[model samples]
Target: MSAFFPALTAGADPGRTAVRCGADTLTYEGLARAAGALADRIAGAERVAVWATSGAHTVVAVVAALLAGVPAVPLNPRTGERELAHVLGDSTPSAVLAGPADALPAGLDGVPRIDVDLAPAGAGPVRTVPDAVRTGPGPVLLPAEPDDPEVPALVVYTSGTTGPPKGVVLSRRAVAASLDALAGAWSWTADDVLVHALPLFHVHGLVLGVLGPLRRGGELRHLGAFSVEGVTRELGAGGGTMLFGVPTMYHRLADALAGDPALAGALAGARLLVSGSAALPVHDHERITAATGRTVVERYGMTETLMNTSVLPDSGPRPGTVGVPLAGVGLRLVDDDGSVLGAYDGETVGEVQVRGPNLFSGYLGRPEATAAAFDGDWFRTGDMAVRDPDGAVRLVGRRATDLIKSGGYKIGAGEIENALLDHPGVREAAVTGEPDPDLGERIVAWVVPVDPGSPPTDAELAAHVAESLAPHKRPRVVRHLDALPRNDMGKILKKALPGAG
Candidate 1:
């Protein structure tokens, strides 16, 4: 039996709810039987793709693929034709598992289609794994011998910022390690019931939000779509103990808190509130915390590294930081000269590098890219950050986009964005570096003003940022916009900004 989900084999109540999406609810027994039955159908397949919708079908299909020891690649429902074609051509899965009613794009027409059945299991106690689908004991530690198979469990693709999205191969061991580490950090247990409305295509929503609960024998309540009303109903009903969301969701919540008392009350009742995929602006963080007395914790990770650092539930929230390295993960910062920085002064910014069992094995069919991604055992994250004396990490920005070397001083765009967000005139802000004859790279601020008709002047906004942060960190140029371009996960697409490379 696979050891990833112990709730099934732990002799727990069969009728306990495992996953709930809107009106659809699946008990532990039901999920086990459904997944095990489907696992039997594709036991020997090398790889499979799942049309990742925000629904129970996605959860069940992914669980089944993991049970059968086949790598599952989650395809975003909104992927464009060219990118979709690239992913399909790159991964080359034999079949595509999708919900019964999902209208898969023509790009997937060539692959054999397998409709995941979401029917309830027969009335009886269920075995977690049927004999036909059992894949050994499941998910061993890393550093497996060369002779070991080390089959990957998932092939999550990166957001094609640099090029066509590369398939990141995540082994079962890596997934299990990540979940276990998070369980320890958050004091997560079977008693907790999680609530979220995040899409199932990414690691934050699928791996940690869905699989994390299953690993800990907890319950998951997924909102089909993100709404403050949904959050209130789920968390206020006395069922949900935790909530997970991205900065965009939290930002909306912060905005609604002033008018919606129910939302504030519900958020206050939750035990843990987590934000990931991008940094939560300090302005929004302060607003939410002040209204609900619940500080939202932030965690840092990517497709290649499942999770590296997170703010523990017990630790008081640091508004701008993503806490410390998770258990079993080694985190360090390296300067431009490739020297590891020994200071935790929180001023010197360096490239964040991490080594841990929770990391993906490699990018599928891209050995050269994989080799370039690693410096020895440590994965070169390409994220720039600084460490506090207490070991908390504050991510400045991505190496390719966020770090701005201007006038002989290196700057991170996040602090400037946060400073701009602090201004009442600014509604949304994104910072980038553009080529400059004098500063090498000039700091540029793309802002969405609170009032479009009468926006703050560039000089005024620049002074606001300079007063809030530092003169050098202030935006050299400010561009007003209707909105910032964002991905499904609500991360700002900096490369899409004007004048960006």
Candidate 2:
């Protein structure tokens, strides 16, 4: 196939708007020219580091790097100087791009820096001709011989909550396949204008939100930063047809619309609204639907595999489940002994293993780490899950985040939370294992009460738990919360919980 992006832009009007940043809009043609110029500027660099906030500049810079056959490492703009210095030391990028020169990290003193200017909104005539640097090119060719599908296309670092972030190498074929799979799975078409607000450095934003639309010749309206008011305004402008947001974003939108019916009417034009990156609580889901009259389709994915499963059309999206594997993806659950668990029995819960085109090739520069993540061709997703009779996959929880060994007993916190959610007064619950001096670890329950006035006491919750759970499974400590600390995707930050080790 011809280079994927050029094919999408071919025959299309170059002046058609490709990105909208605040008051500025960059047409497809303008974006291409800027990308080409940026590519030429970094032509001599083997790899380039870009520290940018969400916007057109970051997107174009990334695309330009890919076009120029250089590996682009996009770091969070909020990354601190020490961390940036470490990345600079590791990658030794030939150049760096950021919004402010003074904000640049200490180690990038010799690296060339480029500042991007946001295009003015409807301020000037459309330029038909490509810029000099872009037009001067005879034939743009991929610099690296990426014939080996396993070679790294982009190196994305993890968020590093557990430890220092390590570079994950996503291959060209892998990234392309992910885009294709997502497009096919969602039935995305050129007519679709995706309203994207997620940060570009994240996989969900880069592959699914940006590349997926571009690969399908779809339009993208990028919001610089996610804000309830900004999104409401964008929706009212009549361009966005679909939206993908994290659970926290959904909750915020719901809260905004709940107080204003006009805001809800503005969002009514969207065909679908999706939630991912974390489990979307049932309350939030119901609230969003009540506010916007749109069902928030929740999907499950990770950094290693962009998207493995989803709640799709025709399949009923059960309240607590993440639906089924996406099209062209295969999933198998394996026990601790490596026995492949079949989908026939609904009750079988095991470690989720995935084999799909969307899976990342390997972790960059870490062969042992990459090898440990896979079992032959199937990637060993550390998540624990179960497939029900309806073929829906219910995420039990992450293996690393789930099982707790305490007092000579293995406990599954998800099972406890599931039990607690069934209680009348419990709106939301999260169970975590806390380190104990004598018992090795102890189960702690953090609950959001439906009625704050009559919240369930520790003894009351213990009695309820005792009725349903085994002796060891019952939580010894119970904490009540108005809301749990959650990320943008609404995934609870268990590690950040009070009294958590």
Candidate 3:
């Protein structure tokens, strides 16, 4: 098989910027030299760990691991101690690659640290690997021998909702296939300079944000932190062509666009604006489109399966729908009784099961979980969705929490949440199902109001929801909060909400 990054060795424009974070920049030549040297040091390792900070060092370390043909485990930098300990114990990486300045947590005390060096070729001295951990041959600026496509590339851990986080082993082919499919979907090209401030540990930020640009031979400008001002500066100055963001980021931009013409102009100038990690609220999407005339393209995927479906750039914006399946991916909707649904009437809800080259190998060391995740060849996604006649996938909610079986109706929490968001008094909303004596499950709305002192009452909110949607879909109970709990990627943590019990 050919190399994952053909530009690194194919004598592309060496002077072009490959990756950058603030003042730190790495040209293709510099990246090849630095990552190549680091790859040589970790060549023989069974698995390596990357302290995935939102910086250039983390990118270099992961690229080095891939070049060395070693599977890399990306650990979130801000992970709590107990969870971090669990991940460290579960993955059992031989060495943890980190920036010299990063203060690693005590959970990783026993693991040997490999300091990633990003200094220019002649810029003073650089950090070297400890003699005890350096078992590979001398440094060489070349790809490792035997470019096997089946070799594991990354071991990304999933969020442990039910239990401890399981390691998802993504192979080299999966990563390449995902990026290539997304490229086709988005009309991505080397001329497109992608900009985002997504967290590096997750697939959205690391694999798609970082690796996608590399695979396309394009530039990546990562904001160390996300801010509307920073985003405006990058795109406004004509440096960035593509923008990748989650809903929260777009929500903030939508809120700010009214007063910031520069921000609006910058967004309007971008070739593509993509949103993932979570669904962008229709209110925010509409506000953004109204302000900048750019509809944010939303794509759907999970940790186990990479890029599965994306709204094609030419298809126009169809709010609330994640577009058709990508190339080489086989997707189907299965009913509760485990029978396949053939009709695409856009009303029937079913679990999404996908089989494709984009899927991960399995959960690392957990055959039971790996086995349970799949039914025959298709991987059961646990996500519930409906398909339009044109084959667009509209996710209603997750089967575990988002799907509310109440009064003999299968309602997706997302639509309820979207309806609640449309109300001017509501700022943030999360819909969930609570057990009820009368109804099988009661739809509960947890909301952060625009004005806490004069928040909307339960009756008013319920009436509002009933006005927009069906009467049965209205929230039976409404809980007001100052704010909603969210993960690093800006996804609302429904289980963490107060009164979740």
Candidate 4:
């Protein structure tokens, strides 16, 4: 595939603003020139590490790396010395770019450093008009072969929600395809302005938040971090027509918007409101729609596959289901015997697998794990899903978190959890199988109460569950907590729960 950035830059209006951060705005022409200059400076480097905070400098660094035919590994600006050391050791980048000279990681004695702030514009009569780098006679078009669709382009490390994080390798074609599908699916236009508040390192922000809009020549407003006050201010600033966020972000925004009616007017200008990276609770979805007069389009995706499925237009947003597969993507429900389960029958529940151009090449540098995840190029998603009669995919739960074997009888924890969540008093619930000598394992339920002071007693909850579920499927033990443990994305950390290990 061709370099997407160059193509986008070639087509964009050079005088139009590309990125806006706080009071800073970089025009497309200026951005391309800066990226080209920086690319020329780092032409010889194989790999480069970018450690600057989110802003114009960081964007330039990323574009420069791509232009120079080198892969850039973006580290969280707040990354500590120990974490930086680990990343440096793992990636062995030829150079590091930081905001300040002192921000550089320690112990890299011999590696050459180019202060991004001080990089000079290329010498020669400056071209007045914007031109495609590929078409121009310059060092910017380095000698690089056509990108193999399978070669790793971006190495994004997992968030370690379950265990030790691994770097996921996504190919150029995968990233390009994901961008194309997202633009086409969302109906993105050059007139669209995206209010981006998430960090850039993760897939949600990198591919969807940043590259997706850039590829379509849409403007991006980058916020340093997520905050209700900051988001409200940016939304009110005008020109923000689209919003993307996680569940936690939506909850915070909903609370903020509820207290202030004026905030609703600011958000009313947006055309699309999206929630992903974690499950968007049904209650939260209802609250957001009621407050903003916009439906939160919740989709399911992971780092391995940038995006596999999404809720489409002309469809009523299902509260629990994540809609059907995206265009160019194929979804399958497979049993242990490798039989493809048909979606026509609503009762079928099996492992969700995806085969498509959007799927990643593999996990970086981990052949064994990568090999195990694929069955003839189809990725085993490890998620247990049941498709309804309307073809909407409702996630039952993770296979690792669902099956609870007790006395040789395997029980699905999702069934029990769903039953518990059905209770009006139950706010959030998680079910895990704790070891028991008598039954081999017993079902344990951890619940967050709707009202903290008036949480239902264990006996009451147990009896309530008994009415709807089988005797064996009811929770043997119920533990009330203030809240269920969730990660940065608002996904409940099942592995962290008691007896989950």
Candidate 5:
């Protein structure tokens, strides 16, 4: 009864496409019937593990688990065997729902498997259950939904500083609040068709991308993969208005815009273009806007915090900022000494702390780690940020990797990285701090040169940084790499960089 979507589909056209992924598609009626059927099969299960993939089966499996009122633990399909096993041991799921378990990944052996039969969309008759829900005879009648707001809905596993990925338990209430707030922020509705090619394991893809549209009774067209052809094909096929992507996808889009007129026009025609997971470089933002006349809105979020801030759809783009704290989300900056700052002059940097309904209930099994993550009720996000007087929050970088202390001046690595990126010789850049006897921590620049045959020197990069930012913040050490190592979400793996402090 506390679910967000069942009632949303009421009075709406059941024949409408709820999800369309490649050749596979599902109507609203089909989604309800399929989910209700699977829900009945796993009625009393406490937890279910979904082998998250970009397919109709994975989407249906997750929806079925939610309908059954069970906490769903989404497993990253590409995760290593050891990491996958740790997740299974920590969050013992009653069943693992997947398309085909034939080539089962390592660590999933001996686990109960519920094969999700993905019927072609719109093929089956929508049979009605007793609770005004349409269900097929595939699994039987679903259990009556109980009105429990605090019920654990999702156990999204995120990697810990040490050991395996720690599961973050997000309650039903939290999910509901987050989706509703986002709807208001983005002017989302059922009439709009959302387009995205993001992965289904992380929150950006699963929680928001998959579930958000369903909750609002909107049509979603997933590209299955990110490609310029896919984006143009989907968006160009009328009614695809909203698009979601990370910085990498946007960067590719921006890079190709000059040569592709159809792509630029299709992007310009979109109602909204959103970028998240990592900061989109200012250069890319400016290039896309210059070509397409459409600015990509950036939002900030994490596995632990579903969504914190977003640049509104109507708000003109601010190159480097991720806008203000979303509705019902409280944000503050905490200095290194643990004192909360009162004013935002846009210069002082502090660790961002947030308290809101969107936050997770706790880290599963590790209660001490959960307690340590929060200061009272406010979650201490290790990201360093500087808020403008107008309430826009600009991320500096991670406290662990980007905050460099040198020459009695606390410097942020993101600004230096951006400055280095502005140089024509630099193809890619990441900034970190290495300990030095004179400066305590000297600023170091990791650069991917545009031309390896004639690369920029450490002195040239140092002068570039000095011209762009404060002289003290200039990089004293420059190391060139062929390319920067990035994670699945397109975030630079700072720890993976050599000589990181």
Candidate 6:
């Protein structure tokens, strides 16, 4: 509805802190000047690539791109050379933007590089910023209000867990729609200080974590790197009111809270704590809530969809469910046969389909894939979920990966994983299905036990699952592992697990 972000800075207090990353701080006035100066030089480029590292530079690059009305392509700093090359070839930006020479990651040999130095204003160590960047006039800034909301804002590449990563084209309208809806849904305001130590490459971290605070005229405190000490110190200082993190981050916090009463007391003072990227285990949720007197809310969305559903900020904590659809978002569960689901029974699992202004335009240069992604107007999310009577949605698992048909019964591996996590002896758990002669796909549990010397046996684990859930949902076999492989955002790479046969 309003200009994405740049306009918010115009009439606001100049001294208000807009961002804080590590030791760096950028006031709203400073951010506007930095982004405006950089945007001037690159205004003509249709697209630009940002070395999306977690810090001031990534924030500046993305904001400059938005101010210039050019699409910004965020490249994962940990992206492999092959994946990096594919994104470069597909998006074909005029230049790759990085913070400084040393801050840039490897793998950009052909593209022209542009550096923007965001050293705090009135600094002694400010020679790194080129003369052009310091004095050059910026291109025409985005209108006070959006002249064209449909204009492309970002070209975010997917994780490519299955195939080559595709560029997800997000429009200005979609980005604005999502952030505005979230601000309303969460009751976010300029007075709120958002804190997180998440990576800045994906939607969870960059779009919402970085851009969200900017649009809402709030202060963002980025940890640069996450640590229990950093979280406790920041929250204890009374600087942070809200937190955004993945399940793994919350898991670490939960463990820390168990040991530190001060940390629990600090967290108890925060207004809201939200978790995403993956389902937070019900056990961890209980542990944190018991200690902090606060439950972390979980939200659901994908790269193709900016933000869809979230646990209502006002509602009581419903661990394991991702809550209801956001304003203007349409959500429905569809059967395998494409039939609409009946009333909310809380047990019937079906695929999630959504449609709204928050949906991405399409995958860059992939018409067939884009066409296949949507069922008519609704985007086929491929994620499975069950809705409760009050419209809250509980994520089951991915259809291609996490759904296991065992002995004619459809099973969600997530439920089994939670059941396994509940075992006192189990510290970490992941559930998948392997081929079996008797059952269609036998349930296999991968666990990192609390006491490695005396871990839970397959029979013991199976009995534990059976006692909590149905007898048929027990893990048929158990595999021991030191740790489960996870991506930067804390999602388990189920495909990496062995014994697929």
Per-residue lDDT tens digits of candidate 2, residues 1-501?
225564324466665667676555666666665565566566656788777567777777776676566788887766777777666676777777665433665556777787643331222222223322333434332232234555456778876666667777777777887777666667778778788688888888877787777667667787877888767777767568888888668767876876877668767777767788876766666777777667777788888887888787445446567878887788888988999877655556788899888788676667888898899999988888778887788776777777677897656676678678767789779988878998998888999998999998888887788787677778889999888886543578888777775
Q: What is the lDDT of residue 114 in candidate 5?
A: 91
* Least accurate 10 contiguous residues by lDDT in model 1: 139-148
Clashes by residue pair, model 5 = none
Angstrom error of the Cα, residue 265, model 2: value is 2.5
| Tens-digit lDDT track of model 6 for 1-501 | 226774344456767899999878998767776776677667768799999888898898898888777899998888877888899999999999887754554668778898886742332211112122333333213223236888999999988877899999999999989998898899998889999998988999999999999988888999999998888877878579999999889989888886798899778989999999999999899999999889888899899999999998779879989999999999999988999997698788899999999999999999999999999999999898888999999888999888889998888888899989889999999988888899989998999999999998889999989999889999988999999988989899888877552
Q: TM-scores of all models?
A: 0.95, 0.85, 0.95, 0.85, 0.95, 0.94
Give Cα distance to truth, residue 400, candidate 2, Å: 1.5
Candidate 4 wrongly placed segments (more than 4 Å) = 6-11, 77-86, 101-114, 118-151, 160-164, 345-347, 402-428, 436-441, 460-474, 498-500
lDDT values for all models = 0.87, 0.72, 0.89, 0.72, 0.84, 0.85
Highest lDDT among the candidates is held by which one?
3
Better of 1 and 2 by lDDT: 1
How do the residues 1-501 of candidate 3 rate in per-residue lDDT, one tens digit apiece?
Answer: 117877676457877899998878998777876787778778889999999999999999998898788899999988999999998899899999999999998889999999998852333222322231333334334554345788999999999988899999999999999999999888899999999999999999999999999989999999999999989988989479999999999999999999999999999999999999888899998999999998989999999999899999888877898999999999999999999998898888899999999999999999999999999999999999999999999998999989999999998998899999999999999999999988999999999999999999999999999999889999999988889999999988999998684
lDDT of 5 by residue, 130-149 (tens): 46243343433444564788
Clashing pairs in 2: 14-29
Checking candidate 6 for backbone clashes, the offending pairs are 40-138, 40-139
What pairs collide in candidate 1?
Answer: none
lDDT tens digits by residue: candidate 1, 284-338: 8899999999999999999999999999877876999999999999999999999
Residue range 338-395, candidate 4, lDDT tens digits:
9998865555678899989988777656788899999888999888887888788877
The reply for model 2, stretches above 4 Å from the true place, is 6-8, 100-102, 117-151, 343-346, 405-429, 435-442, 448-455, 460-474, 481-490
Global lDDT for candidate 3?
0.89
